[model samples]
Target: MTKDEVRAKWAVAKRMVEITEDEYASHNVEAQAIKFVKTKLQIAIYYLSQLDEHGSSYTMPFTGKQMKEALKTPITKQNVKDAADWCHQCRLIRDKACATWNYEEAKTA
Candidate 1:
């Protein structure tokens, strides 16, 4: 379902005394999707700020503290950490999926 639909369901669920299984699932999915989107956005901003040096794994490039400071909303440190962790997990998953080495040109990498 679309994010807006999920959000509308969640809002209605919040007003109910007892939520159904489907409502619970919708709320859960919405929460996870929100976090995933936020993490991706933060990842993009964090990496873009690094210019070309971000490719080097030797350095952290930017820390969670820096990200928090860079944010305008004054979010908590835990939120920043969680987003960074989620972004790192996404990166690792992509790398693992590409580990089959099925590419036609390996040297180009």
Candidate 2:
């Protein structure tokens, strides 16, 4: 996902969590949950930014024909499918396209 895409998702998540300045100031359990979610979002942002810096043309993390062939043990197709699903959910790869986060917009936001 691009940086803007990530930010858009973050905004959605933030709203879903209903983070408010007053709640943040209180720093209670709800605040902690928000912090945890924010941290995860930040990590995703960082990973996406790094991916962009490395270039979008790079190969996917795993699941190339060579990678599949290299496995000695019998690998279930589901394993690869699961990994791909997780990657997509994490925004590591979107629509099989390698994209990095746009840090400039993220920073400004």
Candidate 3:
């Protein structure tokens, strides 16, 4: 997603988080449903973070030949292990976006 789109999704997720928290606090039932929704929202947030605004996925830190080889290989545990650093970078970017949004909201509040 674009930066703007990411920010918008983060805002929506924040609102949904608040709503789900309130729902859990106010009701005596359906806790599982609320938790499930929150989980899905979080997954969406992270998945989107791995894509650029143009919707192309970010690549791992590899040479062109390595990237091609990796693509040809089936996804395995080793692939995820190798991509940990890239994943961490993406998570940091996502967190920064969310933090900037929260800071802006805090200023207004």
Q: Which candidate is the best by lDDT?
A: 3
Clashing pairs in 3: 1-53, 2-53
Span of ten consecutive residues with least summed lDDT in model 1 = 49-58
- Candidate 3, poorest ten consecutive residues by summed lDDT: 64-73
Write the residue-wise lDDT of candidate 3 on 58-90 in tens digits. 443334343233223343444444344444555
| Global lDDT scores for all candidate models | 0.42, 0.44, 0.45
Which candidate, 2 or 3, would have the higher TM-score against the true structure?
Answer: 2
What is candidate 2's lDDT per residue for 1-109, written digit by digit as tens? 5656555644543343343577478666545544444444444434544455434544435333433242223434544444344345546453234324355733443
Q: In angstroms, how far off is 75's CA in candidate 2?
A: 36
Which regions of candidate 3 fall more than 4 Å away from where they truly are?
A: 1-5, 18-29, 53-109
Global local distance difference test of model 3:
0.45
Candidate 1 ranges with C-alpha deviation above 4 Å: 1-72, 104-109
lDDT of 1 at 14: 27
TM-score of each: 0.31, 0.34, 0.33
Model 1 Cα lDDT, one tens digit per residue, 1-109: 3434434534432232132355345556444444444545445433332222223232333455544443324345555565566557545544543455446422233
